[model samples]
Target: MPRRFWGIRRLLRMPVTEAGDQYSIWVGLIYIFNLIVGTGALTLPAAFARAGWGLSTISLVFLAFMSFMNATYVIETMACANAVYKWKRIQSIKRDSVQDHDDHESDEPSRPFNDMEEPLVCGASIPSRYYSLDRRVELGEMANLFLNKTGRTMFYCTLCVYLYGDLSIYSAAVAKSVMDVVCSTIPANMTNVTDWDALPCFNSSSADPEAYTRMGCYRVALVTFAAAIGPFVFFNVQKTKYLQLFTTGMRWLAFTIMISIAIHLLIGSGAQSRPPAFDITGTPTLFGACVYSFMCHHSLPGLISPIRGKSRLGLHIALDYALISVFYLLLAFTGAFAFAHLNDLYTLNFIPTDNDNLFVKIIEYFLTLFPVFTLSTSYPIIAITLRNNLQSLFLDMTRLESYNFFLRKLLFPVVAVAPPLIVTYFLEDIGILIEFTGSYAGTGIQYLIPTFLVLCARRYCTTLLGLGVVNQYKSPFSNIAWAVFVLLWSFICVVLVSVNIIQKKS
Candidate 1:
C-alpha cells in the first residue's frame, strides 16, 4: 500500500524473472553446497594429517579464495560471450536475439532476463551497447569462442582427464568402502585402520597393488559396483529429482554424524594432539588435494544459470565459499585431532568398536557405507555427463542433430565409461589416483583454462563492444594483473608437483 514499503520489499525479494524461470536462491545454493562436499572431501583428513593442521588450514583458505575468484571470471566470461554474440546478431540483423530465451547457442548472443544481469543499463536504444548475460554459454563454449583450436583441445583433454579420474576415484572409493565394511570388523578398541590392515586379503603395498587385485572381497565389490552402475551409461542420465532429495538427506546425515563424532572424540581422551605446526614435505600433496576439493569452477554455469533472481549474484557466491571454507576447516581440524592414525578416507577413522554403544555402531556402519552409496549414485551421473562432453569434443552438434544411431547409441557411451572402468579394475589405491589427477588436470581445469578464457574474453569484448558497451556482471578482479597472478601460481604449482614426483621416483 505504501511506496516506501514496496521499494524495500522489492530489494528483499529475489530479482524478478519470468514465472517459469524462477527458482529460490536457497535451492541453487544447496546445489553448489552439494557440489563442494563430494568424494574429495573424504581425503582431506589424511592430507591435513600429512601436511599438519597449520599448513592445511592456510592452504585451504587461500585456495578457496582463488577458486571463488576464478568462478566469478567464468561468469564474467559467460556474460562477455553473450555480449559478443549479441554484437554480431545486431551487425548481421540475424535471428532476433531476444526472441527465444532458451536458445542462447554458442555462436549467438541472447539477452539476460529483464537486463537484471547488466551492471548498468544506460537506457540506450542500440541493443549492442547494453549489458547482457547468457546462461547457456557453458565453459566449453567459452573456450571455443575465445581460444584457438590448440587451446580448446587442451581444455577438453584436461576436462576429460579430470572426469575420468573422478569416475575412477568414485569406483575405487565405492569398492573400497564396501570391502572395508563387509570384509572386516573394527577391532574392540576402535583404533584407526591402516590400508594394509584393512585389506581383506592382499598384502605388501610394495608389491604391485593389482597383482592379486582380481582375488577376494574387493574384486567382488568392484564387480558389484560396476554391475550396479555400468548399465546407466548407455542411457540418457537425466537428473532424478527424488533420488537427489534422498541423497541430499543422506549427505547431511552423514556429515552431522561425522563432525559430531569427531568433536566428541576430541573432547575426550581420544584426542592425540600430535600435528606439527607445518610439514613442508607434504605441501605438494596438500596443494593438489585442496585444488581438487575446491573444484566448482568448471561447473559454475550450470549451477548459477538456474537461479531465479540473481540480484547480488556475486554476494551469493561469496557466501557459498565462506560457508564451504568454514565447513572444510571444521572437518579437517576435528579429524586431525580425533585419530592418531588418520587414513586417506576420514570415515575409516570412525569405525565403531565392539564395546561401543548401539548408537555408535549404527553411526559407524553409516559412515562405512556412506561413500559406498553416495559415490555409487554419483558415478553414473558423471560418466554420462562426460560421454556427452566427449561427443561434443569430436562431433559437430549440427551434424549430430540429423545423424544416424550408431555413433549416438553405441560408440559414445562405451568410449566414455570404458577408460574409468578399466582404471578401477586395476588401480585400487585412491590416494595416488587423487594426487595425480588433482596435480595435473585439476590445476589446468581450475586455473589455467579460466584465467586464459577471461583474458581473451576481456580483449574480445573491448574489440567487439567498441569500449562503450558495459558488462554489468564483470568480475571484481577484472584486471590483467590478477589474471597473471593466477597463471603464475598455477605454473609454480605444476613445477613443484613435477619435482616432487621425480624425487619420489628417484
Candidate 2:
C-alpha cells in the first residue's frame, strides 16, 4: 500500500484475465495437493520397510524436491504456450490491420508500455498487452506445439503405458483389498495372516463347492471387480463432484485413523520391531514408489489454469510440496515402526484381529476396504483415459468420421480394460506391479517429459518472442545443467531398477 512497496507488490502479483468466477489460489493449491496424494501413498510404508527408514526419508525428500522442480517446469511451459498463443493472435490481427484499423487500436505502435510488458525482436521493443497464465493448454497440446512427430509418439506411448500400469495397479490393489476383507478371518494373532499364505479362504474341511485357496479367492475378486467396473469403460463416465468429495474424505479419514492406530500400537507394545537405518535391497522399489507418489506434472495445467491470481505461484507450489513431504514422512515413519510385519498394501495392516473390540473392528474393516472404496471410483476414469489415448495412437483424428462405431468405441475400451484385467490374474503381487510401472513409465512422465518440454519451450520462446521477455513462472532449476542432471538421474534409475529386476528373476 505504500509507494516503496509497489515494486514488491508488482513483483509478487500476477493478474490473469478478469473472470469473476475463477477460483482463488488457495483452491488451486488444494487441487494440486489432492492430485499428488493418491494410490501411491498406500504403497509407501511397505517401500519404507524394505528400503529402511533412513534411506526412505532421504530419498523421499529429494524426490519430492525433484518432483516440485518438474511441476514448475510444467507451469513455465504452460505460460510459454500461452505467450505463443498471444503472439500468434497479434500476428493475425496485424495482417487484418488495413480492413479493421479502427477496431484494432490496441495494436497501434503509439501505445506506451513498461519494459517488462514488451517483447524484444532484433533488439527492438515490440509492444503488446502482457500475456498471463489464463489459457488452459493441456500437456498433449503442448507436445504437439513443441515436439516433433517422433517426440509426440514417444510422449503418448509413455503416457499410455503409465495409465495402463495405473489401471493394473488399481485392479490388483482393489481385488487384494476385497480378498483380504472377505476371506480373512480375525486371527488370534494379527501378524499370522500373510498375504500369500496357502490357506484356503473357506474351511479346508468344508464340503462346499465355493471353497478355494486364498490366491483363487483373489482371482475371483478380480473377475468380480472387472464384471462390476468394466462396463463403465464401454460407456463414458466422469468422476462427479460428490464422488470426488466422497473419495477425498474417505482418503484423509482413513489415513488419520491409520496413523492414530499405529501410534497407539507403538505406545502399547513398545515398538514391536526395530527397523534398520538403511537397506539396499529395497532402494529400487522405493525409487519407483516415490516417483509415483509425487506424480502430478501431467495434470498441472488443468489444476493451475483457473486461479484468478497467480502471483508467487511458484512459492505456493513450493509450500504444497513442503507440506506433502512432511506428511509423507509422518505416515511412513509411524507405519514403519508400529508393526513387526507391514503389508504391501498398508491398509492390510489395519485388518481387525479376534481380540479387538466392536468399534475397533468396525474401523479396521473400514480401513481394510479403503482401496475398494477409492480405487473402484478411479478405475473407470483411468481405463477410459487409456482407451482414448490408445485410440489416438492408432486412429487418425482427421478421419474420425470415416471410422465405424465399433472401431471408435467398443474396440478401444476392450483393448484398454482386458489387458490390465488379464495382468491382474497372473501378477498378483501389487508391489512388483507398482515397481515396474513407477520405475519405467512413471520416470518418463515425471522426469524426462518435463525436462524435454522445458527445453523445447525455452528454445521456441526465444525464437518467437525474443530474449527480452521472461517466463515469470519459470522453474528455479532453469539451466542446461539441471536438465542434464534430470536426464542422468532418469537413466540411472532405469538401470538400477532393471538390474534389481534381473537379480530377482535369476
Candidate 3:
C-alpha cells in the first residue's frame, strides 16, 4: 500500500517511454562491462595456460563458434519483434471493429454490417470528416497509447537490467573469494620447488609455503552458496518484463565480455609457470577455466528486444565474437609457447612477491576488491526482484517502502558480509571451485541459452508465423544444423565439467 508499491503497480499499468528507452543503451553498455570484467579478467590467463598456448588456433575456433551463436540471436530477435508487432496490429484492428460495431448498434439498429466494414458510401464520405475528424482522433488516440506503453516497457526493461547485472556481480564475488584464498596461501616464490608432479592442484602446492588447505575449502563452499542465491531467486520469481530485460542484457553482456577477455589475453602479460598436461583430471585447470569462461550464454535473451530493431546489433555481435576468438587463441598459443615445458598452471609464480609491478599488482588488487563492490550493488537488486515476485503470494506482505529500506540497509550488507567471512575460514585452493562453477553454470547460461532460444524460435516460430517469407531463405535443415552445433559444444561443456568433478572427487 505504500507509494513505492503503487508506483510499481503504475509502472506495470503504463507503457514504455522514450526516457525509459534511453536507459536501454546504458543497460547495454554495462552489460558489456560486467561480462568482460567480472570473471573473465581473472580466469582467462589460467585457461590459456591450460590450453597449451595454442592461442591463435583456439581463437579461431572460438570466433567461429560465436559467429554461429550470433546468427541465432539475430534470427530470434527479429522473429520475436515481428511477432509482437503483428500481435499489436491485430489488437488495434479488433478494437476499431468493436468500436464501429458498438456505434452502429446504437445509431442504426437494423444495419446488417458495421460502419467500419461498409464501403465508404461514395462522395458521402465528406472531406471535412475524412480529412480531419476521424483521422485526427484515431491518430491522437494511438499516439497517446503508444507513448504510455513505451514508458512502461522502459521501466520494466531497466528493472531487468539491474537484476542481470547483479548476477554478473555475484560471479565477480565468487572470483574474489577464490583470489582471497589463493593470495593467502601461496608464497612469493617457489623457485626451489622440484617435485611439482606431487603438488596438490586443488589445495596448496609446494608453491604455497604457508598453505591453508582446510580454510580454503570452507570459504569456497560459503561463496558458492552466496553466489547461488541470485539465480535461485531468479528462478523462483515469476517472469516479468523486467526479468526479460535482465535476460536480454545478459546475452549481449556475455558477448561483449568474451570480446574483452580475448583482448586482454592477446595484450596481457604472460604468466611465469607452464601448465601441466594433466592435473588430477586429464584436463588441466586452465582448460577448466576456458570452458567456464564460455559458460554464460543463458543471459543473452534479455538483449533480444533491443537488438531486434536494427541490424546493427547483429553486426555488433559478430564483431565481439570475432575479437573474443582472437583473444582466446592468443592466450592459448602464447601460454603454451611461454611455458610448455614447465609443470605449473600459473605463468607468474612471482605475483605474490612482485607487488611492486604496479600494473599487475593493481589488477590483482582490484580483482580482490571488485567482488565487494559488485556484491554490494547486486544484493539490493536481487532483493527487489525477489520482493516483486513474492508480492502477490504474500498479499499482506510488508509495504514496499519498508521492504526496500530493509533490503538496502540491512539485508544487503548482511548477505554481503556472510560470504567473505565464511570464505575466510578454510581459504586455500578456492580457485578450483570458481573454475568449476564458471564452467558449469556460466557456460550453460551464456552459450547454451542463446543457441537454444534461437534454434527453437527458428524451428517453431519461423514456420508457424511465416517468418521465412519475410527474412531471407534459409532451410529448416540449416537452422537445425546451427542448433546441433550449439548443442554439441554445450554437451562438450557438460562432459568437461562432469569429468573434472569426478576426477577431483576421486
TM-score of each: 0.78, 0.77, 0.51
| lDDT for residue 363 in candidate 1, whole number 0-100 | 80
Per-residue lDDT over 194-303 for candidate 1, one digit per residue giving the tens place of the 0 to 100 score: 44434434334546554443235666788887887788778643333345456768877887788887888878777776788799888876776778788867656655
List model 3 lDDT by residue over 123-197, tens digit each: 322211111100011111211222245533433333333333334345445444445535444334632334221
lDDT top scorer: 2
Model 3 backbone overlap count: 57
Question: Candidates' lDDT values, in order?
Answer: 0.71, 0.75, 0.41
1 or 2, greater by lDDT: 2
TM-score of predicted model 2? 0.77
Off by over 4 Å in 1: 1-23, 86-134, 185-220, 223-238, 373-381, 398-414, 426-432, 499-506
Task: Give the number of colliding residue pairs in candidate 2.
Answer: 0
Clashing pairs in 1: 119-472
Give the per-residue lDDT digits (tens) of candidate 2, residues 1-506: 21222332342243444465467787677657666777778789988988999999999999998999888888888888887866665555445543454554443244322233322232324322334577666676678779999999899988877888888888888888788777756345544436355566765676653457677788989999999888877754322234545666787788888888889988988787677899998898788778888987766775577776687899999999998888788788899889899887688777767854888889989998888876865676566656655665677643566999999878989998998889888877766666667788888989999999989999998888767666667788998999999999999888877876776788
